[model samples]
Target chain A: MTIRQLSVFLENKTGYLNEMLAQLAKYNINIIALTVADTSEYGIVRMIVSDPEKALDILREGQFTVRMHDILSLEMDAAPGSLSKILNLFTEADICIEYVYAFSFGSKSIVVFRTNNRDKAIEIINENKLKSIREADLK
Target chain B: MPREKMRALQTERLKELVNRVYNNVSFYRQRMDEAGVKPSDIKTLEDISKLPFTHKQDLRDNYPFGLFAVPMKDIVRVHGSSGTTGKPTTVGYTKNDIDNWSEVVARSFTMAGISSDDIMQVSYGYGLFTGGLGAHYGAEKVGCSVIPISGGNTRRQLQLMADFGSTALACTPSYALHLADAMAEHGYSLSDMKLKAGVFGAEPWTENMRKELERKWGIKAFDIYGLSEIMGPGVSHDCEYHCGLHVHEDHFFPEIVDPETKEPLPDGQEGELVFTTLTKEGIPLLRYNTRDLSTLYREKCECGRTLVRMKKITGRSDDMLIIRGVNLFPSQIEHVLLELGETSAHYMLYVDRKNNLDTLELKVELDESKLTDTIRDLQNLSRKIEHALNSAIGLSVKVTLVEPKTIARSEGKAKRVIDNRNK
Candidate 1:
């Protein structure tokens, strides 16, 4: 129902992201799905990795501002209006989508997002009979 | 006060003050004993040079109540200035001390022609800083309609000025300019209020500032000077003549000394201003070095007062920077960073005047061992440092988290303070 994500704070400077990714690569950590939320000052590098606990320790030891959080990932048919259909359920339920990103594999797409009401969003997925992905599934 | 009479009174008070501190405060007693001087040594006003000068560090070393001349029960009020570290430079006042403080303040208000009929709006901040309550007490003594509206809340300051028709304002010179700008931005005109005169102090301002403030509000702006250690804002004030500020020599004696040599400079020679609290009961100081740079004048002023006059403070001999009326030292900022425990002490302070308001921005180097990838965490870290500094110094500083090792490391004594306010 949820996947572990690593969020790192990076200043909006040249090669800052490359520096962080290089550090993760040093530990042989594999980045599964990644996205960046940024402002003029800095950027938040959010990623789902194969080994989150090891990645967290490595980044923390390197003196990086990093944290881990659980976000929901839904597997949907890789088709037109697939994201819109899933989003409509949340909009009708009055549950806010804080942020959303997607990655595709085979004939299906995995949509990752954090919501204002996590418990309610989970309940909506269950009632609507949606396929929810987990950390093991992403790996 | 006439010249001869003023000198006689100062000599008498100086004798008493020396006797009090020498007998009560061991810090002062030890200092005097080391200088091979005694209470009887201060016979004339000139004998003050024979005594050792107390530096700001002396107050820090004495800490909270070590330098107080009287018992804690006798102290009626306490005020403090920001120090370089955790402890503040504390000053106490007895009942008689408060009365003398009110007298000098009332006299200062009188110098600017602010009287009983005028509605005085005291915009200086209140609480431990001393500016707010100092002006409030003086305005009450003058029998004026005292507003007591402390600093900030610009909209309310303008509202009360218009509705209450305040004729006099007492605040920092920069704050006065800020208020004028706010008034215009809020669609206010001078005709809407009855503000006529302003008494500005607590920060070093220039003659050009006096002219600018006078033109902005169409009011006569008078400079008032004092420090919390020497009884707040009533120690000296410029008379209507505006030649120089007339030191309330009857209470606080003023002197000029070469900053490096510590030798007393002659009258009209620019040097560090020093003071001797002649009548203070709570914490009587013996030739305290103020560290402020200025000249002294003993000539009879055109306004007919014979009190010794001190020229406008040109600058300070130390690295202390006054931002928005709050005395700030770069060492204080460094102390905050070190206290934060996560950030390095390596930092730089950029001080600038934005729209006539003093703005301080602190650039802190992010520790390589504490890099967090989330901007939220970084924002929280910066806010934490900002809150700590604000509580410590009483000034809101904008904290900018810079790249690791981005702040250049110097060979010896890092040039931390980059003040652009003068430019």
Candidate 2:
């Protein structure tokens, strides 16, 4: 139902993002999926990387404000209505999705998101028999 | 008193002060004995150099009551300045010492042209700190309708100024500005109040600040200089002429000594300011090095006071930073950081004046040991440091966490303070 994600604080300066990415690239830690929440003062780079534990150590060693958190990733069919169906479960359950990002691997689509309700969302997903993603599966 | 008569009186008092301290205070006794100088040696004002110079560390070394020239039974009150560590460097005052303090403050008010008809609002903080009670007693002695309303509570300050017609306001120059801003914010202009004179001190402020304060309140701003170690905020004050502050030479004798060599400099030469309490009975310090840098002018002031005038203090010989009237040291900040064991020794202090208020921003390096993966942890660490610093220095410090190597380093000496204040 969930995989580890790395969130990093970045100053809103030019080439700062590149500097963070370069640190990861130097350590051979590949970023799988990423999204950035930005404000005028700073940015939070929320990312799922190839080796999250190793990537956490590397990014922190490079002096980045990095944190690790659990985020839910749902596997779905590669269709136009796939995300709409998965999101409708949360909307019907009155669970608010904080943020969402997606990518496709062959015929299967994956939607990774954070939500306000974690336990209830997990129960709904398990009861509905929705295919859940794990950290091992990502690795 | 004329210059010659004042020096003669000073010489007489100097001999008595040396005898008092050498016979009463063991600390001063040992220092004088070690220097091989006897009380008889201080027969004239020129012989003050024969006595050993008292450093701030001497006060700390004596701690609570070791430096007092009189017994605890004779001491009436105590005041102190916060030290780098938990212990405060304390000073005690006898009943007569308090009277002298009041007299000096009264004289200071008189110098500023404040009279018994005026209403005075004393805004300096009370408690063990000397500013509040110091000015309060002086204003009371001057027969001014005294408002002992200590620092803060700006709306009430302005309200009292309007309702009670406070003619004189006394506080740090910065707080006076803050009060002015607060008055404006509360829709009360200068015309609404009856502030005629402002006695500003406890912190070093520039002439521009004096001009701004005068302009803001439409009052004549006067600079009053004093430290808790030397009797509080009435040692010297500027007259209506707005020249250098006139020292009350009859009680506290002022001298300029080279900061490095510790040799007496000429009257006009800029050097460290030193004072010898000619009349203090409780803690009679003989030639105490104040660490303040200023010049002394023996020339006759146009206002006709023959008392020696000292220029406004330019800087400190030490690294003590006065923020909002609270004395702080960089080593104190480092001690807090070390005690927390959360930050690297490398840190920098950024001091700036924001909206006429002093702001102390501390930038500490986050080391690997204290580094955490959560923003909450970092925030908590910074807050912890802020709380520690606030408790240690009695001043609110803004703590900022920077990368370990972000603060600039130098080979000669790592810079610790960046004071961006206009002064």
Candidate 3:
């Protein structure tokens, strides 16, 4: 399973995010799953995009400081305890999940998460036979 | 017979300098007394070391007329260096002094193979700064048809150079390069110009720059070195060989010495250049420190002049930079920047110390429309500049790419470096 993630370095200013989004719109790059890590000064707008490479190129060419990072995406049943089950397996395997975000597309639930121990998390996924999606898998 | 007569004349001038400095300037008198030496101690040229060394700061401390040996009424002209802060170091010249200054500068023209038949255009700035008037008077003294085109007006400078059949030009090396660029922009060929020789000075320039200017303008580039403190633009000049500048030691006694210790050094050893004005009647100096770092030689020159010669000034003691335990000069940075080709002349160095490490950040202005603000391109240029600076200065510099027209230009002397690293 593949997940698209955008890492944009934002300077502290009003309407900077809006300006960045407008630039993306001009370049015809679409944002799908989106989240923001914010500080008092600026916010890092992270998004799963329809075209990650083109979005990155457009953002960079427009002079927006950006980086691309790999994220783990898991497709689960759109049930109440699906994310909870994944978290319990990570806890039992002694893998610390830094943060997690989830979005639903029809009946399928997609949860993206980061762990301190990526290898341990991958092992737990294999042992528990959990469905894990990579960035290439989405493409 | 000629050598004996020259020695007698030099001795007579040296005795006059000793008496003037001892009687007139109290600083020199005190300094000479402290050294257990009197005016009577100087018998020959070798006795020059017995005198006290004069420094540029001494001129600054005294300000306008404290260093003059003669009365102010006898002083006919006053010129000065363009100092940034406070008052500049003012130099006074009597009528005889002006005549001597003109003679030395005229000799510089003759060394460059410029003759009375040549129409010389003097482009150095005039006024308090001595370059313009100095060169103009010198060209006139040499019987050359002089065009006192005192700097700027690049269009008019070019027009006069062409129209007046200007066979020679005198300006700073940078201005000469600027004129060449302007000529190219106006679709004029330098090859078609009657210009044969160029006497470039008032700033230290490298031999590479000489070659570049010569190749561009098809003229012989002569290095004329001088300062207002030392009577301007004819202290020393390059001959046809262009090996080293020959100092008129008969008029001005040249010495190379340790800047800090004040002890004289052997020939070929790079040290601070010091001069004692022998024949200067108004403001004769007793071993005035020039601060310019260069070596000296008393060997017979191929140009048939027995005067002492000095190497091209590599750098100034005041401008020596210690960056990350490495010493650097602005000329080194200029060489690198000129080699890069795409960067503008505007550059500002931001030096800061953090975590006990000295950091040098060179903010280079990009040429207009040369490179966009794309992250990749900026990073690439930064890397390229960093590598070049590291190789040139022997220290890694954080290259900050700035837009054009950010850095300020100096009207008189260009401030090439901003040094913030202090002990």
The CAPRI category of model 2 is incorrect
TM-score between model 2 and native = 0.88
Candidate number achieving the greatest DockQ relative to the actual structure: 1
**Superposition error at B350 for model 3 (Å):** 6.5
Candidate 2, residues A32-72, lDDT tens digits: the string is 88888764444568888899989989987887767788888
Worst 10 residues of 2 chain B by lDDT: B368-377
Per-prediction fnat: 0.33, 0.03, 0.00
Alpha carbon lDDT at A13, candidate 2: 79
lDDT of each: 0.88, 0.87, 0.79
Weakest lDDT window of 10 consecutive positions for candidate 1 chain B: B368-377
lDDT digits (tens) for residues A65-98 of candidate 3:
5777777788887778978888999888788876
Q: Residue by residue across B40-102, what tens digits does model 3's lDDT show?
A: 999997888877777767887888899888899999999876632234678999999999999
Residue lDDT tens for model 2, B49-168: 888999888888888888998889999999988444667889999999999999999999998889999999999999898999999999999999999999998888888889999999
TM-score of each: 0.81, 0.88, 0.60
Please provide TM-scores computed only on chain A for all of the candidate models, following their numbering.
Answer: 0.95, 0.95, 0.89
Ranking by TM-score: 2, 1, 3
Query: What is the lDDT ranking, best to worst?
Result: 1, 2, 3
Between candidates 1 and 3, which one is better according to lDDT? 1
lDDT of 3 at A130: 80
